[model samples]
Target: MVELLDNQRTFHIQVKHTSLVLHVLPTGHVTVIYWGKRLESKSLAYVIQDIGRASYISDTDGIKDFKLEQLPQAMPTHGNSDLRTPALVLEYADGSRITNLRYKDFKVYSGKERLPGMPTITSGEEVETVEILLEDYLQQVTVKLIFSAFYEYNAITQSVVVTNLSKSNVTIEKVVSSNIDFLDAAYDVCYLSGAWGRETHRQVRPLSQGAFLLDSKRGASGHGQNPFLALADKQANENSGSIYSMNMVYSGNFQAIAEVDMHQNTRMQMGINPFDFAWQLVPQESFYTPETVLIYSDQGYNQLSAIYHRFYRECLMKSSHAEKVRPVLINNWEATYFDFDKRKLLSLAKEAADCGIELFVLDDGWFGKRSDTTTSLGDWQPNHQKLGGSLSGLIEEIGQLGLQFGLWVEPEMVSPDSELYRAHPDWIIQVAGRDPQLARHQYVLDLANPAVQNYLITELSTLLEKENIAYIKWDMNRNITDSGSSYLAVAQQKELSHRYILGLYHVLEILTEQFPEVLFESCAGGGGRYDPGMLYYMPQTWTSDDTDAIERLPIQSGTSLIYPPISMGCHVSAVPNHQVGRITSMDTRGIVAMQGNLGYELDLTQLSTEEKLLVKEQVVQYKEIREIVQLGQLIRLTEIENQNQYAWLYRSKDATAFVVSFVQVLARANTVPKRLKLAGLDAKAYYQVGERICTGSELMSIGLKLDKPIEDYAGQRWLVKKIEK
Candidate 1:
């Protein structure tokens, strides 16, 4: 709920267990007074009065108030006598760079409103909002700060809408989505950072007296950095203490910064990066920033993550497959690679269907003159030479076997040898006088160009219309380099990266809206672009290119910190794993992969009859518990480290069913059984486990013991169902 204490000049917004209090000072500048646990409606006027003395220091001129530098500003501005990191920076037509804003007005509403061209929380009666307006009288600019409070989630969504009200145009250098301040620096910053094939590794460091930045400028939410940051108290853990998190719902050039001022005050800001960025704001033109989610959890990191998971699962993902159980799919990428023919693919599909797999995805070899990585990337048509029949006929054959068909395409890449690229060499991103750099034997198409984007849309739409494709594995195998667009002017050339992301989002929006039934799984060389922005279009993303079970434990663990399980695409590949060459038990692989959208990557036709039976059983078991695994609350029972064990627990939303998956990493000479205490259960109810029944209290207090002297790489999965008295 959102309330305005007009008498005290304070705005109070509460959502579930969290509250945010903002006060308007006598100078009309807004500052955050308190943001943490839920608080009663009370006046904070005295708090403002205490800092009133600093408003006018004897050393400063009578016209300037030094207090603006001390107050915890809601949106700090540049050239306002405050030296902090400004949330709004602008350059005017007259060469003046001053921006001083004050509270103009505010409006309270019943439901949340969506931000244009961006992902945001869904609107409902349970959600409330307050939009506060701030204006710069000298520049004739208006800024609207929007806050949304969700009743079920301990989160407040924030965004900014900046409108130019002057007669001429203005240049916007930087405008952040949200800026928040804490009274003191008593927290540690936690973020996710890593490289390709080893993405989203968790890193935590203490907040010192300087600025710490977590950002991505690789034209995508690159594998090197993720757009998430959290500030947890020094004493915070998984279950206790105060935690503040801000995540940007954008895919391109983004920044998240935590700055500690001289007064020991800390300010956290997140939005689009200002480097190489300048937006032209014409008169009456409004620029809308992407929404940033702020979650306050007095209970700790797990509580903070739970709020994000619930919000994304219900609000961001818009496809029809968002709430449904995904099919147990088998992809032929690792199995056949670029060597599959019509007979080979049909054999694989037939075997996969017999093993109860619902879908078969033909990856990387079905289109163009493409048999290898060096050719035919831009061509989207089917290769009749390899298929030996019409594409629709093959799809019909697969459907006749009671299996769905999926195809893979790299729509944003073009090979130098391909027909499309040969015809239109200027379509790719490159400087006019330089040789375009190549990665993965391909050049990235300049999606920022309208012609290039339109061509791709036409090709993809034609294919989707011609065939009965149920799923699409959209892949982008290369990063952007030599970032210069031929269509943009010299001054606007620096806008290529951001414009590229906008173009990609535009294509996805139109395609997903037209074919809402098709399940789209995004892959940027596997998890490179696995972010909230992509999840808004595709419900799930391939977790990583490295499908090795042992390596995946840490990757999935760190990814789960910010993203939900339903958004991760995990696959069980062959032992002697293609990526890492590590041989792990198939059971261990299946158990690990089941924690995500479960699927298979290896050749099922090559398995022995007994192994095939195991595959069938795994498929059946996954079907029985798919709903709980996809929509349940996930609890990490064991920390992911270089230890002998890793475990996870999934509990139904209603607390009636739960499943625990445990894996023994390696064998030991002489070891005792490890006991794990489970969480999120009905303490008084009895649960049936296999043939035995135990009270939830016993499981929570006494714990469950693992099998002693377990074999290396052994895995166990246990299911418990609640029993009524």
Candidate 2:
């Protein structure tokens, strides 16, 4: 609920267990007085006091004792007495960059307000919001800081809308979605950072006096740095201590930063990466920044992650398959990389159907005479000659075999050897005089162009309308380079990156709404575009292209830091593992893949009789626990840093069952077995695991024992069902 104490000039935005109190100073600057545990509606003006003109800190508004530099400001501005990082900076036509905004007005609303052209929390309509308006009268600019509090999700969404009310054009040099200040800097910083094939590795360090930046300037939310950041107490862990986290609902270039000022206070900000980014606002035009989800939990990282997981599952995702049990499918990427004929795919699909798989995904090379990745990206039409039939004919054949059909298409990219690019070379993002750089032998489509958007909609709609496609692996295999749009004017060239993301969101919005029942799983090579923004359109993402079970432990574990397990699309692939060449047992691979939405990605026809039987049994096992594994509350049973053994627990929504998955990456000889402690079980309930019956208390305390004399890259999973009286 959002409460405004007008008499005391304070606004309190409260979720279920958290509260953010904002107080308007006598000089009209809104400052955050408190933002931690929930507090009642009262005058919090006394919570903040100035340092009274310390060295290098000057007075403001003729108030000797109060200075903007020392206060925990709500909307800090540039070129002001506040010497720390400003949340906003506007450049005017006269080359002036100073913007001092004062509180002008405010509004309280019942339901959450949606950002005009962005992917955000829209599923939850019962959220409360308080929008505080600040204006710089000199520049005729108004900034609205919007805060939406989600009661059930225990989270808040923050976004900014900057409007240019002046007659002249204004340039927004920097504007973040949210800026929060903490009175103390005694916290540790945590973020997800890694490279391609190894995305979302958790990194943590103590927050010192300087600034720490987690950003993605790779045009995509690069695999190098994900758009998630958290501040935890010095002694924080999975189950204890205070934690505050933020994730941007955006897939473009973004920045999440924490700056420690000289006063030992920490300032946290998240939004579009200001580096090489600028947006021009014409008169009467408003620029809406993307939304950022903020969550605070005193129960540490697990609680913080639970808030994000539930919020994303309930509020962010819009696909009809969001809450359903995902189909167990096999993608033909690794099975037949660009070298499959109609007969080859039919054989594979036949074997998959015999193995009880529910879906058959025909990956690349089925379109546009595409024998290799160097050609035929933008051409969505199927190569009927190569398929020996029409696209629908092939799909109908697969469907007759008791499996749904899925297709892979890299629609956002254009191969230079394709017919589409030949007709419209200007459709690619490129500067007028500079040669466009290519990644993976393809150029990114100029998504910012309305012409391009309409063409994609028309082509994709035509194909999807004609064929009974159940799922689409929408992949963008390369990051954007030579970032310039032909449709945009020279002055707006800097807006191409964000504009591309907005355009992508628009196309996805229409297509997903049009085909609500069709499951859409996004992939950017694998996991590079795995941000909350994509999850809004596509229910899940291909977790990583690296399908090795042992290598996936840290990747999936770190990704689950902010994303739910259900949103990860994990698949069991061929042995010698393909990516890392680490040969693991088929049972271990199946158990690891079951941690998320289960699938297979290898040549099923090549599996031996025994291996094929194992695959069938794995399918049966996954179907039995699919719902609980997808919708359950996930808790990290062990730290992601534990290289020897890693474990996690999932409790059913009704708390009637629990599943724990553990993997031993490398077994040590003559070592004692380790015990895995579980969490979030009904303390009084008794659960039956196979033949063993144990109370929840015993499960949480004495724990489950690991298999002794463990083999290399071994894994195990147990389903504990409550024993009713």
Candidate 3:
């Protein structure tokens, strides 16, 4: 519920257990008064009166009583006499760079609104929205600060829309999505940072006096940093204290900053990276920033994650397969790579069907003149030489074998040796005089060009129309370099990265809308572009190229902080794992991979008869409880940081079924059994675990004692069903 205190000039937005309070100062500036647990009282006049202090005294004569530097502003702008970071920066055609925005008006609505050309939370009866308008009189620019409150999820969504209102054109250098100021700086910042194989590793540090920024300047979201940032109280932990997190719903170059001012006030802002970005805004033309999610949790980090998981699954992810049970498929990437023929694929499919697999994914080398990764990327035609027949013929054969067919394509890349690149070299992103750089033997396609985007849409649509494909593994294997587009003017070269991403989103939106039946899983050389923006189009993403189960423990755990399991595409690779060369048990592999969109990535024909039987059993077991794993509430029981054990629990929405997965990284000679207390269960209910019955209270308190593993890298999965009173 949103309440406006007319007498006090304070607006309170309360959703579930959280409340955000803002007060409009006498000078028409909005200042954030409080954000955290809901307040019991209504009046915030005391908060406004207490703002005057010696530390906040401004040098100006007329405004000595009201200081912009001391005020906890909702959105700070430049040329406003504030020394802290500005949320909006604009340049006028008359060579003026000053910008000052003040409150103009506001509109409170009943339902939520979707962000244009971006992913955002869906609204229903349980959601309320408010749009506050601010205007820069000097520059004739108007900014709209939009906030959507989801009562059920206890979350708020924020974004900004800047429109050029004057007859003259204006240039926007920086426009952040959301800016929030806190009265104190007693917090620690947490973010995810890592590389390709080991993506989304968690890191935390104290919020010092200066600025702490996490950003991705690459064309994609990149592997070095994720678009998520969180601030927690200094005493916060997994189960207690206040935690606030912000996740940018953008896929391209983005920035998140946590700045502490001289008065020890904390200001957090996130949006598009302004390093090389400049938007030309003509009269009446507007720029919309992507939505940023704000979640406040007083319970701890786990509670914070649970809220995000629920929101992403129910609202952000709109793919038809988002709520459906994903098929237990087998990918041939590691098994055959680029050396698979029609006969070889059929053989693998036959073996896979025998092992109860539901789908067959023919990864790479199926299209173009492609025999290897060095050629034929942009060309999407099936190679009759490699397949020994037409693509439709092979797909029909696979369908006759009682399995669905999937194909992999890297549409955003082109090989210099291929026909597509040879025909249109200008379609690749390159500077006028500099030579184009290549990664993975490919050049990044110039998606910012409308002709290039239209060509891709046409080629991909034709293929989908002609074939009976059920799934698509869309991969981008290289990061952009020589980031200049041929079609854009020299003055607009700096807009290449953001424009490229926008173009890509347009293509994805059209394709996904047209082919609603086909499930598209995104991959950027594995996990490089795994962010909420991609999840808005595809249901899941290949978590990483590193498939080692042990290495995946930390990777998956860290990713779960912001994304749900349904959004992670995990596969059980072969023993002596191809990525890390660590030989973990098949049981452990299956257990770890089962935590996500479960599948296999090994050569089934090479396994022994006994191993094949085990594979069949594992597939059947996963099918029996895939819903619980996909749609359940995930409770992280233990982390793999300093311990040799990692564990988690999944509780069904109805609270009747649950699954617990415990993995032992290393074993000791004579170690005692460990006890794990489960979460998200009805305390008064009785649950049947295996053949034993235990009350939820007993399970959560006394906990379940786990026996020591007989060997290293062993794991166990426990299934529990609730019983009637």
Candidate 4:
């Protein structure tokens, strides 16, 4: 409830807790350099001061006096709980400014007092609990960065740094990824990733109107791929494990810098949206990303990717994981998209009921009177032609076949030609009489409508009651357009965007509660809808819709640099793919797919004899190492972006299992074979390779060699079945 520097140019201040709105400078800098939180009436006091104990300072290179220009503080005219964008802005001495700095790069230095009955913090005390308590340590947090930048049409290497001058070691983990809203003719998310390395990385797939880094590239390691410029090297070297990012759109800009220390266990994701810049995270050291660099782009995919690399080198940081993740997962979109009746579904269910396939999903055209992507959006009903009856009925049928049944829905959209739209014309988001705009030939539904929200909940709840539906595929295709809303008052217009997202959260929370067993996969036209906000509801996500396995190699490779493989959802689809039209080798395709939640997306009903046999063997092999792929340690043995080679590793959940994918992109003679020493093995046990057996140490020591050149860019998979004696 305090205000810092409120001016058109430079901003400076000290506060217990405050809301910020900083502007963007094109010099490649993080605008709001500081320290921060909360929702509704539930949020009261930001922080309490220790009284005469906590101090402040802006001392750094090229430092200057703090200035405050007279600026009117407009009344919100609504409850804080209703909606608000507490933005942060950064200004340079030379009259330049930028906004949107990562929360991770800021630091706080102050002593803490035990507010009677509350946990205490003291030096050398095994790190007592560190909470952003409303009554105590809120204001104690200060924003800082070793090297940062704010940019508008360009990047400038500016740096800010803050330290924990307090007596105890500050623990600052849990700054997760960001959730942002965009406003435009139609908002877009043109994203990119860094250089490719060996191993399978998920790719960024285009949504109807936006693009996102699907799969593993949504983390700090992933930021290396964002198409943004980096801070100068000397500045970036000021601290290790720091974060850098740029957020901009066709008309806006934001950037940030955060230096992370070992003592603080907090981690966060960095990125930008059209309207806002943010980082999301849980304040737990249990698991998170340490640092990252995020950027925005305007050009198509290629140009954006190059921009992402411009900022990659400066944001590099080594990443370990809470655990490895699954890479391959079977998607029903290719297998079946609103084409199956109960009997036909049952037939396909039997095909996917094998040991290799983990989950079987039914894609779009499934619910809400939706026969196609154009209608039945607000109406969440299963078309009789496809379902015959209830979704639950189909779920039960699939269960009988011993497979997990997954259903798809797009709750955030609506169609003018459908019942939901006609019933509540006001429920659609349009600029008054501006004739609702459309993307993918569809209009966006206003979840901002309580009536719309209730309908979605009612429809979703009714379906969940049918039987055990193991998974839900939440898909969103377009960005918001014609932002004016009839439902929200003028004062509450800003709330429309955030509220639309919140409304999504409310529904998801309810569904998750009603059916705790179901695993939700958020797919925003593949990755557009991807944000930490969804992760709060669904643990796993579909990385992208571009299923060309070869193009996906770089995508997945780049993705894994930041995300765990298990969390990535990849699939082996037919060559001459539906999108990219690339016909890669079946073995090469399966090899790429095996790095994820392994499953097939192509039609299995009409496979050729040899294809069927090959697929059968693959199914059997995947089943054998499923555990390792699902929850193991992932090691990228090759750098795909750097060379024509592929190599990656996954060790079992118990650390007892392991699998390695070695694809030689180009022939190499005496290229110093990379020896990936296996972990979690019983050195006590001997490992035999091929005809001749070798010690586990020997294999790790010498490794295998390819006999012929990997021409036509072909490869092989060495599945090591429990070290043979």
Clashing pairs in model 2? none
Question: Residue by residue across 660-707, what tens digits does model 1's lDDT show?
Answer: 998887888876776878877778999988888999998888778788
Predicted model with the maximum TM-score:
2
Worst 10 residues of 1 by lDDT: 52-61
lDDT of 1: 0.86
Model 2 stretches astray by more than 4 angstroms: 6-8, 50-53
Give the best candidate by lDDT.
Answer: 2
lDDT comparison, 2 vs 3, better candidate: 2
- For candidate 3, give the lDDT of residue 92: 91
Candidate 2 residue 663 C-alpha distance from true site, Å = 0.5
Model 2, span 587-686: residue lDDT tens: 9899989999999999998989999999999999999888888999989898755767888888899999888898888778777886888889877889
RMSD in Å for candidate 1, one decimal?
2.1
Give the Cα error of residue 50 in candidate 3, in Å. 1.0
Tens-digit per-residue lDDT, 541-591, candidate 3 = 999999999989888888998899988899999988998789998889999
- Candidates by TM-score, descending order: 2, 3, 1, 4
lDDT for model 2 = 0.89
- For model 4, the superposed segments whose C-alpha errors exceed 4 Å read 1-330, 336-338, 354-358, 389-393, 665-686, 690-701, 707-713, 720-725
Per-candidate TM-score against the hidden true structure = 0.96, 0.98, 0.97, 0.61
**Winner by lDDT between candidate 4 and candidate 3:** 3
- Candidate 2 vs candidate 4: the TM-score winner is 2
